[model samples]
Target: MLASTTTTTQISSPPQQKFSLWSPPNPSTFYCSSQLLSKPNKHSQKLQYTERILDQATNILSVLYPTSTKTFSNKPLASLKTFIRDFLKKSKTTFSTLQLALLYLVNLKKSFQNLSFLQENIQLLSDPIFKCGRRMFLASLVIASKVVLEPAPKNIAWSKLSGLPITEINNAERLLLSALNYRVVLPFEEFVEWNILLHSPTVELFQKINLVLKKEIWEGKSNEEDGPHYFVHYQGWKEKWDEWVPESRGLKMTEENLKKQKDLVAAHTTKKPEKKSEATAPSSERGKKRKSEHVDTVDEFAKRVEIKIPIPEELKIKLVDDWETVTKNQRLVSLPRDPTVTQILQKYREHIINNPTSFNEKEGLKSSVFQEEIVEQVTDGLKLYFDKALGNILLYRFERFQYVQLKEKLNNENNGSNNGTEKLGEATHAEKCMSDYYGAEHLLRLFVQLPSLIAHTNMETDAVNVLKDHFALFLQWMVENADELFLKEYEHASAQYLVDAKNCTS
Candidate 1:
C-alpha cells in the first residue's frame, strides 16, 4: 500500500442567507434530499441530533458486521459510542470535527472494495488482513480527525488516547487508506453543506422515520418471538417519538399496515384449536404428552441456536483445573509459550500435508481433505480468532499482566535498532506476531467460545456442521497430544511484576 496523503481545501466564508424549508442556496452543487426538507411535525421539538446520528451509525454497523458486533464484546455499539464521546472529551475537539469524522466513516464503507471485502469475510467471522467493523471505523475516525484538526495528534498520541496498540493503529491506518484508495479529502463547502443538511430543521426526525434493517427481538420479546420490525421514525419529528412496530406496520405510519396488523391479530385471536380424540387417552395423560412434546421441540430449537461445541470430559476437567489454579491459587501461565499457537498450527498443517490419508481417516472423511490452500485459510482464521479473543475474554486476571508485557515486548522488538523499516509497508516479523507468544491453552478457550461466535455468523447449517466436525477432530488431536501441547502447571507471578501490574492498574 502507498503512503496516505491529505489534500486540504480552503474556502472563503459566505454571507448568511435567510433559511427556508425548500429553497436553500448552496455554494457547491450538492443539494439536500427531499426527505430531509420535508415539513416538520409537532414532535420535532424534542429531537436530539447527536444521539440520533450516533444511533443510525450504530445501526449501520450492526447490519453490516453482526458477527463482529457479537464477537468483540458485549453491547459493542454502546462501547463504540462511549469511545467516540471519550475521545472528543479528552481531545477537546469541536463537534464539527465529530461530524466530519462520521462523514469519513460513512464514505469509507461506501468504497466498493472496503464494503465488499468486509461483507464477504465478515460472514466467515474472520478477516486475515483487517480488524473489521468497529475497530476499522474507529481508525477512520482517527484519520479523519488528523485531516480536519490542526496540528493533529500523531498515531502514538491517538493510540494513547484511544487505548489501542500503536502497531494496531498504525496497521489500521495503512489498511484503511489502501481500501479507501487515499481519497479522503473533503472540500470546506461540501463539509459545511453536509453538516447543515444533517442538522436541518426539515430533516426527518430519527424517531419518526426510522430504518428497519433486520429482524430483531424487541424488548419484552423472547428469542423465539423475534421477527421483522419496522422502526417508525416520524418525518421531521424528534427521536423520542420513534417506535418499533411489527412488519405489518410500514416504515412510517400507514393506515394499510395498521389494518393489516389488526387483521392478523384478530385472525390469531379467533383461530380455533384442533380437537383431539377423547377415546384413546384421558385428558390428563393427553395434556402430559402434549407438554412433553412442546418441551422437546423447544429444547431442540435451543440446542440448534446455542450450538454447543463438543468438549471432551478430560479437556473439561483440565480447564476446570486450570481455572482453579488461576482463580484460587493466583497462578499465572508462563509467557511466550513453548510450541506457541503458530508453531502448533504450522505443525498440524504439516502433518495433514504429509499424511493426508491418515488425517482424513481420523476425521472420517473419504474425500481428500489435503487442499493446502484451504488448510492455510482455516489455520490462519483460527490464529486470528485466538489473537483477537485472547485480549477480550480468554485471559484470566493473573494472565493479563503477561499479555500486556508480551505486547510491550513485541512493540519494542519491532521498533528496535535493526528493524526501522516496518513502518514503510514491510511485513511484520514472524516472531513478533501475537500468536507467537500464546499457546494451545489460550487457543483452546477460543474454541470453547467458538460456537457463540459462529452462532452470530451468517454461515449455513451445513457449513456450521462441517466446522463443528473439524473442531472436534482437532480438539481430539490436541487431547491425544495433551502432554506436549497443553500447559501442565502455572507458576505464581513474580513480586516485581505484581507491583508493576498494581501500578499500571492504579
Candidate 2:
C-alpha cells in the first residue's frame, strides 16, 4: 500500500527540466502554448529577411560595390543565428525583441537607400556596397542603433558589440549618408507596417515594441491626431499639366477619322488670304517643313532614348479590342496620360449619364468591369500616351490607387479602436505628392534613372523603344506580389512626395 501511494504521487508530480534540447523545454512549468510558440522571436526573422534583401540589393555590385558577392565573404555575423538565439535565451530582461526587429528594418531601409544613391548617381561608376548578407545586416543594425539610441556609442564601441571594424563602420556610414535622401526616423505607423514581414504577427510583441519605441503604434494605428504625412510630389504638376495636356496630346487621327474631319471642314469652310513672315514660307510650304521637322524630332528622340518595355503578347491583342468596348458611341479620347483612371472613368460615367447609353451597363464606368488591359495599355505605353505620359499615368493611376486601397484597409481594420482620433495622414500626403511632383525639370532625369530600376531588377537590358517595357517585368512582379508592405511603402512615398512639393513651394 505504501509503495503504491509513493509511485502514484511521484507519477503525478513530474520532474522539472531546464533548457533541454530534446524534451519539452520546461516540462514541470505550466505555460500558455501561445507564449511557448512566440518564444523564438525577431532576431531569427531579422537575419533571414535582411539576408534575402541583401541578395537583391547587391546583384549589380559593380555599379555600386568594389566587388561582387563572389569576391566577398560576409563575416561580421558569422554566428548570426547562434548569436541571436543565445542573446534571446540569456537576455530576456535586458533586450527588447520588438526594438531589435524595428532596428533591423531601419537598417534594411538604410541599405536600400545606399543602393539607390549609387544606382541614381550619374558620375559614380562603382557600387559603394562591397559586402552583403550578414555583414550588411550587422552594419545596418549598428548604424540604426546610433540613430535610435540617445547619445549613441562611438564607432569603437559599436565595433565591440557587432565585431566589425571601426574603419568598416565608418566607411559604411559615409556611403549611407552620401545620397542623404534616406529618412532615419520614419513615422511609427509606417515603421510597424514595414516591419511586419520580418516576423510572424504577434500582438504581444507589437504592444511591447510600441512601448519600447516610445510611440503609440498598434494594429497599424498611429495614435497621433496630426502627425506628419508623406506623399508623392506633384510640384504643381496639375497646373503645368493644365497648360500642356490638351495642347500637346497626340490626336487620335486614324485614317477614317482624319478623312471624316477633312470632309466636314471641306463642306463648311471658305478660303481666306493669309500673310507670311519674311522668314516663313507659304502656308502649304510651311506645313510640309513643320511636318518634316516633327518627324525628325520623334525619330531622334526614339533613337536617342532607346526605350524598350516587355509585355506578354496577349496584352497587346487586347488593347484596341478592350478600348472599343469602353467607347462604343464616341471616339477614343486620346487623353494625355496625365489623367488618372479614376478621372477617365469619372468622365466616361458622366458621358454615359448625360448621353444615356445602355451599351455595357445601366450605370457604367465600373473599375472592375474594365479589364486589366486598360491598366496595361495606359501604364505600359501603348497607343494613346507618349513615353513620358507612361510615367505620369504610372504616378496618377497605378501608384496612387494602391495608396487609396491601403489607407482604406487600415481604416477598416482599426474601426473598433480608431476612436475617431487617427487622421489619414496618407490622404493629405498623397494629394501633395500628386500636386507637387516636380513637373518640367525632373522629367528627363526620371527617364535616365528609370533604366536602372529595370537593370537592378534582374532585367539587365537597355530600353530601346518603349520606355514602359523596361518597367513591365518589374511592375508585373510588384502587382503579383502585392502585399501589405508593398502598398504601405507606396502610400508612404506618395505622402513624402506631397510633403516635398509643399516644402519646395514654401
Misplaced by over 4 Å in model 2 are: 1-80, 83-119, 122-130, 179-182, 201-506
Q: List the residue pairs that clash in candidate 1.
A: 207-233, 207-234, 207-242, 208-233, 208-234, 209-233, 209-234, 210-233
User: In angstroms, how far off is 15's CA in candidate 2?
Assistant: 54
Which has the greatest TM-score? Answer: 1
RMSD of each: 23.6, 26.3
Q: After superposition, how far is residue 108 of candidate 2 from its true place, in Å?
A: 6.4
Off by over 4 Å in 1: 1-307, 366-368, 417-427, 460-462
- How would you encode candidate 1's per-residue C-alpha lDDT over 134-174 as one tens digit per residue? 67665666666666555666676766676666676776676
Q: What tens digits encode model 2's per-residue C-alpha lDDT throughout 63-144?
A: 1222234322334322333343332222221121223333454343344444564577534224345344434444444445
Best by the lDDT measure: 1
Alpha-carbon deviation at 203 in model 2, angstroms? 18
